[model samples]
Target: MSVRSGDKKTKILNPITIEKDFGGPIGAAFLTIFLPLTTIFLHLCCNEKYLAQGLSLEFNKVKDLFYDEVIVNFKENFFNERIWLVYCSWFFILVFLDFILPGKHLKGVELRDGTKLSYKINGLAMMGLLASTLIARFIQTNGEMPELSFIYDNILSLLCTSIFFSILLSCFVYICSYLPLMMSKNGINTNERILAAGGNSGNVIFDWFMGRELNPRILTWDIKLYCELRPGMLLWLLINISCLHKHYIETGGKLNQSLLLVNLLQGFYIVDGVLNEEGCLSMIDITTDGFGFMLAFGDLTWVPFTYSLQSRYLVLNPIQIGWLNFSLIILLNILGYYVFHSSNSQKANFRKDPASFNQMKSIKTKTGTLLLCDGWWKLSQHINYFGDWIMSWSWCLPTGFNTPLTYFYVIYFGFLLLHRQKRDEDKCRKKYGESWKEYERKVPYKIIPYIY
Candidate 1:
């Protein structure tokens, strides 16, 4: 087939054509080695143990009968657990709907530019996993919290087993999700091709502002490892911190300080992360990877990172509140969001339409105007790093000044950006060589303007 640009009819391969078989034992081997190794590394650093009991319980089927009851207990303990469950349920439903329903896959359909998910298939896959999870939970627990037995006796072990199976199930369903697209095209596979899907389906306001252009696929770093590691790492850290905080609170009874501000900020950060799936996928690391990579990163890394910390911490004790200071907390939280969101928006827009920029200003230096500096870019070639730092700082606000330890994320991010900037600079120097030299002549500082 052919597509027209001007006078030329460009030969276009079927967008869904799978001419080569990339998924095989080799790919599966690669995924297994990558996920578990990274998880183990994180476990070691966090001082977390993959309890043998937990590993054993993960496979026991007797645990499946008591899952619903356990979740009920979970709700009694967590308060808002029911609402959370409902929300999760809805999400799985939506993903499944997109997978099964015609025109919902976000591939080939051209009414909008949303990223594809098999709503129909995703739903079935998720439901199957959820059912299996419940069954595993029930059979393992059997409506009783027996005294801590061993891997064969613990809920956590059962959960681990459930997640292992769930991951396998999700991958199976995900593969099946693509089969329809494949069969429709007579066994053609087209994962790499850019095919328009869901025409003009975005929100009216968003459509006007952003248009239907797909996000650019650019690789500034090898962030696949980072993405895979980040979620699991985050979860584990949260669990450890929770454990620490619980110990502190239990020992001291109640304190004279409040943490409302910090908790709110953390909530916002998490919600924002979920809402920006497209932006997340826009990152070069995700686009460069195939389905196997996605499964490894999303399941092993992200899921564990986000959950482990809170689970560990909450089990230890409760978050105590002291004095409430609402005003200052709100303002700082807002400032943090402004910095983080604004900088990201600027970069996205700039990449889409660099010519939309009105001014072509340059900074003057001993070497002449050179190539660096001007506007926000002049303030910091990597303004987004500053924004990210601010957000991380705000999220840690709830912890207060008891210890600088709570602010680990911000500190870690600062170091990360510095390293990334240096790497980027080195790459630029190599790629552009002399031109990069000229650009740097105009802008000297790395992150903070005039300060760093």
Candidate 2:
């Protein structure tokens, strides 16, 4: 009998099968090598002086069978460079394994399967992120302790300092990683164009990680459902604290002023991105980074270590010093929240029923004939961006400007929106042709009123 099975039989394999099978072994080897090497480096750098000082602190037991001091130590140590390195070492190794191993071919799953697929791991990028994280950690640990030199027990200065660094560090981490990905030749742009051209529209994790054994779409839905149930407001608050506040305390800490007033304002932009939903959805993963970076490293490193688990340490502690600023800060938060939430809601409502809320009219102007009228969109072509800037200012206000670093979020976001708006305009002009010309004539402004 002629064996027809060899030519006809098809094999289906999950993308993760190889990683799942080999991940543990690879991960184990990495930790075994990385941990010891890191410890040796620390030992060499710190020598007996630091070690002796570290060891001298005795653990005083308390309630919860874990002493408060011990708990504090755990929190602080979690943010330390050593712990971060150890954790990253494991993931780094897994990425390394992906690089080395021959990617398997399967009958059912292929990059051309109309689905976006990333068969190889982003080892180089991951390594760069790990390095940047290390640098941030090193600066925090080695940098001069935040001196309360400006005022004799001035609490506001301290709080401002904390907010400044926290925001700065967060921005640093974000920009270092995101800029490369966005600008890379074989990056999100390629994926976006690919998806637009009738290819598979699966989530980014599947495409970036080559883990096709699991349906990434289902996983993404599950994550969204879970996020929806809990709502990330609290998580955002928590994670933001851990990540950003460290620099504040290390450089020159202050009060627990509500940067949320600012974040609330920033939220308007964030929500706008969310409403856009296409680019924004990918942002969460990009920001949080597989929980490996955020949960394992972020919570321990930034939250407890830098800020010492007291978000309000700088803002609340020195009531007398920050009194005037605190009052102003509160007002800013309120304004930010009002503008942010109101503008977003207005946009959402307008989008829901454009005819009812907004009146469409064609107008002749100096530029040309364009669509003009009244409503949210007509109020200003991109009022949401204005609200976004206001919110960013409010958040940065709390930092009180020891350095301009804290304003990075607002500045970066503004630039991002402007670029995006320009890009969208170009696309609209190309797609809508004369309709866009007429619309531009009607609108007359890009982002702000009587300004641009």
Candidate 3:
């Protein structure tokens, strides 16, 4: 292992570590229910579906609403077996493509246990396939595009299927993680188990939520990595496309300008992520976060259903996008993408060859070394986070200054990134000690350049 500089402290909680940041089992239980419920409710808010006409939120009728409205509505609208079969078929085909498609077999960053995992680089090819499939299907229908609208129409059932499958997949992850240990003739060094890097935390609810295995797998396939990219991202684009189709059909082929901007920006982002698929190796999700329910659900359901909320809303709401406003949003996304790509590339290049980043210097710790503050990293501990923020809001903005709902993604993302920044800082402080403190002093801002 290459020696890297660090200081003192406790590190971030591993997923398999029995730490209760969400309060405890009760809290996790609530989240387990709440997150999926919120996923449904948000879709409800965007679509305003299944609500009785003239019904309102009232404290006096809160209990009645819970029993009659929430429970009954969810029960009825939740799952449709036909939709489930179709969606699952779509998903497995993507998996088949991921397996069959060829690309570089890249190695990931070394793990705490010294394992360097491998992942396939077929995302870009899969993305091309996704586009081609959609085009071919639509063209076959003579551009009527009902299949596209089918998703927008039956979104609730689709969400149910994704969430169900995510939970099922997490169960599979938990089981697979322990198979090696249970099967071993010798009392297995549990730590050396295949794909279960960090092992189980022993709390089922927490394990299910946070993930038990560090990098779960199936035969030769990298389950976590494949999930991290394939289904949700292409599904996100597909949902946006469906929204576009719905808009076109509604307005006699006139596209909603706001919807167009949202698609272009998010479409660009997804395509970039796929094309730069190899970079997933060094991402926090790949390196650290476990393959559990939190991620499984998020990658499959939350991402596809919630992340495209604005696009979904715009389909129903159809907001105006003026030329000036569109120009501003375009600029914001461009700037954000530029900073995000440039800052990440800068750090990645420095890691590969510090000499390439001429301004980089080394700080020697008692054991080894760490990179000196330079470029965007010098500006802020997580400068690219700000860039990411800019891009997120720009996508949200075309919804205009109407409902607070449209702005939710930006608001949620800001808080999420802030939590991530602190997590990274804590991890660095534990690893780098006083040197991390010094670097923190040098890079005072946590994300934004002047204002954190």
lDDT top scorer: 3
List candidate 1 segments past 4 Å from native.
1-94, 97-263, 289-295, 298-300, 303-330, 360-373, 400-408, 411-434, 450-452
Candidate 3 lDDT by residue in tens digits, 111-171: 5534466778977677777788778987898777777878888887788778888888888
Model 2 spans > 4 angstroms off: 1-216, 219-235, 240-324, 358-373
Off by over 4 Å in 3: 1-19, 48-70, 73-76, 181-191, 194-199, 365-369
Clashes of 3: 8
Give a tens-digit lDDT track for model 2, residues 360-398: 544434444334345546656777677666666666666
TM-score for each model: 0.47, 0.41, 0.88
Full-model lDDT for every candidate: 0.41, 0.37, 0.76
Candidate 1 lDDT, 281-344, residue by residue in tens: 4543343223333344454443544234222322322344334545565666677677667767
Local error of candidate 2 at residue 419 (angstroms): 1.9
Cα RMSDs, all models: 13.7, 17.9, 4.8
Structure candidate 3, residue pairs in collision: 5-369, 6-431, 6-432, 7-431, 7-432, 7-433, 8-433, 211-292
Residue 118, candidate 1: Cα error in Å is 13
